[model samples]
Target: MNAILIYLLKVIAIQAVFYLIYTLIFHKSGRHSINRFYLIFTLAIGFLIPFMSIPKFQSYEPYLEVDKPIWYELSDLAEFSNTEAELIPVERINQSDFTTELIVAGISLISLLFLMKLIYSHFELIRLKRQSKEISKNGHRIYCSQIESPFSYFKSIFIPKSLLDSTSFDTIMEHELVHVKKLHSIDRVLMEVILSIFWFNPLLYLFRNRLIETHEFQADAEVIALQQDPIAYQEILFQQINAQKVISSANYFKLNTIKTRIKMMNKNQKLSKWHYLFILPLMVFLIFSFSSREGEEFVAPLKNDVSDVFDYVVNLSDSYTPSIFPLKDAEGVKLTASFGKRIHPILQVERMHEGIDLKTYKGNPVLATADGIVVEAGIINEISWGKIIRISHNGIFETVYAHLSDIEVKSGDKVKRGDIIGKAGTTGESTGPHLHYEVKELNKGFLNPVDFINDFDFKRYTSIEKKDIIKLGKPNQKLKVVIDPGHGGRDQGIVSSNLSESEIALMVANQVFENFKSSDEVEITLTRDKDELLSLKDRVSKSEGADLFISLHMELHEDEEEEMMTAIYNYQSEHSAASQYFGELLSKEFEEINRKFKVGYTEGNYVLKNAMSPAVLYNIGYFSNSESERYLNSEKGMKEIAQELSDAIMASKY
Candidate 1:
């Protein structure tokens, strides 16, 4: 059974126990003119409480431990030294496994919900018990001032000690006797429990008040049926009104509703039978609908034949010999210098080129090299490379495309192989229109992408660079780091056009956060999980104990004429050596991902200025140029940027 269904069953069980107790207490008193609609409403609300209560297990991630026992071994009695055979070491349960976590989550939430309700009830009972002690004794039972007058039941009613003699304590005692006979206390307690579950529903509060009022009305009518002086009862009620005490189980002495209850008590007319018919069907429909469970079970299926399918396809393709297709316009797209060797566009001087340049015209459609999600979309300014898109493929492989004239998607958009994501353009610091691309493998140093794509014809291209293979790294069990995604809620930092720097910072930070979360050596935390403003000092203060502090932001340019570039800024203090090292590593990685542009590191960002942990402020890319700005707005562009940044961060050494 699903957790929600189990929780619903538990709630039903608790409500059933309460109902049994109520029935047993009130069986002999005979059914009064109680509203059936109220009973149905309460039961319906009780059923919904479980689903409404948020599940606690939704946040757990799977973890694996490899150190202990593996498989179970059978021990033979003949081999054992002791006559009593001993069992061999068996496999231990993996507590961090995802399936195990789901079970734990369900049980934990049920226990927590039950415990919370119990605690709320216990405190309420204690408060009510203390107030009950204040009631004055009248004959064999105690009587108190009844503000929600006309209460039923034999339980002691409390009245102020001063007003005990002035009011007809005998008449009120007779009314209290009716309440005890009618089991009003049990009704009130049950209603209070229902109220607790639907505390957020305002209508439930109204129902509770109405139910209590009805109880008083019924008790008062019974007292009046005995032919006592109604005038004297009214007089008594008026005198004892000020002497009422607060009752936690039922707010019987609610000042606002007391007069109304009294007037209801005095009225002798009965509700029309036609009105009952009108409400009866509606009440029944509500009861069944509210109590009904609508949850569906979720089951994830496994693909056991995946390897077979891949092998079959590979075998079939290898059977036929393919013709060697010659490139028609290869000269137009050929790079003279190999990737990674710096060559100036005009000066012809060797410079460090991080990524391979694919010469293309303006408005040439750029396609995603693989299936991935776009993590970023915007113009890069002084802080980052211009018009960049980052996409995360499977595992640790990521691809970046930069210097685009137009971006066609936004953050969170999904793309497939060969899908046009943007158009090639010379935006940031570019001498001409062309596509700068980089493919990064996890844990592996950058490889020449040109060699990987050389086989493809120039006339037709698959936006994907299949040669940028990711090399999965060995699990590092000892490494530990925390990621703090800056600024949430109201404190949104600088915004340009529709892009908020704070939101972008958090987006990239979260991508890094998730990457670390998936790793064995990393632990992550956010400065603010939801959007809420934090002071610059607080943002820094929260990272005090972390090993690495990465503050994310999109840099803007004071001068509009500047081209796109990626830069890292670190504090200039003595302890910032580590920060500087991290910056250089990241700068090189960024450059490798997009070799056509310059990647540099500077010092002195306020968030990183203080002497503290190794911290780096990554200004992802610049946005001064128009093409870069448009790229920044596209989904593919953003993902490419985020993936590269995350890859760089993950690649950093302690």
Candidate 2:
């Protein structure tokens, strides 16, 4: 809604600037046709320029980075919690709130009223056409009616019955004939429609009046082109000085601006064609200033966050390095698959095999191939390699052990070579129980695990090292989540007497975090633990390896007499399915607690747009509403809200 308001303001500014330029320099420049087109064209550019996105040019260079090694239907991983139930009813709010929504609605209503008036006048013209007497004069159709003055609507020229027999009838017919031949009614209708939509813009009214004057100028010029005496035309206009006004939708002949119109007719200074060339620079300025600028495109280096371990793996394969076999005394323990391009057994598609699959029975001890510190040891709720462990060895290389049943070592644990880090089993995307082992140098991609394995005969293709192994059992896999409390420090959002939006947002986020910080199945990380303002880009960057991104925010509705409902917005894109599914689950939980909730999709939110995981921006309530502010600040109310949201998030793991 704020984005919509900003766009409208931008359009108004552009139109206002153009209208000012038109009035100061081009109003009486004596080029009616060209000036007419300028007005309409500027109006169109006002609406279009804001949507343009000009990409900046820069030299392109490829960065060394690991690519995704697996692909799956991300939406299919979560079970949607929606059920066949009665529709939920939303609570009502005061309609008199001076909120952004109310302002937009008011503008729409006024525009609609203006549009209806225009439509009714058009229909009246149709009725007048049907009721008036028609006659042919000098290859033109004329309609005689009880109107106050002569006017032209499209192809029909209507004149007052009293003027049909007047001495200046021939001259009046000539003027109306010019309007019909030049399609002046089309310009009037176009301006009228623009006025109907933007009735609040004073500049539009100015443009409309100027355009009508331009139509009269064109018609008067055309009349003069037929060798009509200027003094005689002036006499005709003076005779209609007291004529009653006609409907705005029609081009009526009147003497309201007779003196100005007459001066424009006699004006001698013609607008140079070069004068229009100045508009090119103005157009370029608008394009550069209003349009979105796209930065140079480049690949970002992979972070050390293990959240994306499913996509890229680090492998090591130095023949000079002596590494453990990682499998101890297992029957049929043999090399089943080698690294490189091969058909994935479970996916049935040919893709790069980043790791070598070892044939080993379930519950077989899996040891660390080298002395290293455990970096990642967890399970992801996905279809790719599951129950994985990544070990960073001496800051030079890393090793990955996937498809394990039990992880014995937690992250940050230092272990020697031949220590039992896990047990072999098929946990993710495997046809049978086997160990998928990988190794890689730091900053490099995955290498063939077979190259780093010692005590393995390449010709026999079978290996086992049943010695010097330490065993421990402590399995762990927590759903990592990043909770972003919007606004902080200097960026205090929506200040009130009780609390600001930033304070309240952080309060609610902390409540949610406190509920799950001790849970084994869930892990929560707050983007900001204190009242420190974090940039939207920084917030998204900090949530790099998160499984879910939840941004907490509050709205303001000044003059609101009732509480505003909560809203959950999911990211809108190809990756939106998972976010939408999660939003549905969260909205239901909010509803269960008697909180009226609305679930929608948004594309303009920066945090949501950049999130690499299932993300939602949760608008808690309006801060301007006194009751909502109190509820948000209350400890008990915050606790209940946190409990419901946390429950929904915990349920999404399956």
Weakest ten-residue segment in model 2 by summed lDDT? 461-470
Task: TM-score each candidate.
Answer: 0.30, 0.43
Best by TM-score: 2
lDDT score for residue 274 of model 2: 78
TM-score of 1: 0.30
Q: Tell me the tens digit of each residue's lDDT in model 2 across 1-654.
A: 433445567778888888888888888888878887888899878876665545445653322222232432121111111121111112224423267557778988999999999999989888988999999887888899888899888898899999988998988888888888889888889888888987877777877787888888888888877865888888889999889766887888874789998898788788886787878898898878775333332122334886333222222112113265778654467455566764333222334767776766899999888766676677743357678887765444578788899999886676677889999998865546778888876435678776665455444211011011211111366888888988899988777677787887788788888898788888889999999988878899876767788888776543365353433343335456556556666777887877766454444456777787768877677666778878887887678778887987876665
How does residue 579 of candidate 2 score in lDDT?
Answer: 67
Error of 1 at 315 (Å): 50
Task: For model 1, give the RMSD to the true fold.
Answer: 28.2
| lDDT of every model, 2 decimals | 0.50, 0.69
The numbered model that scores best in lDDT is 2
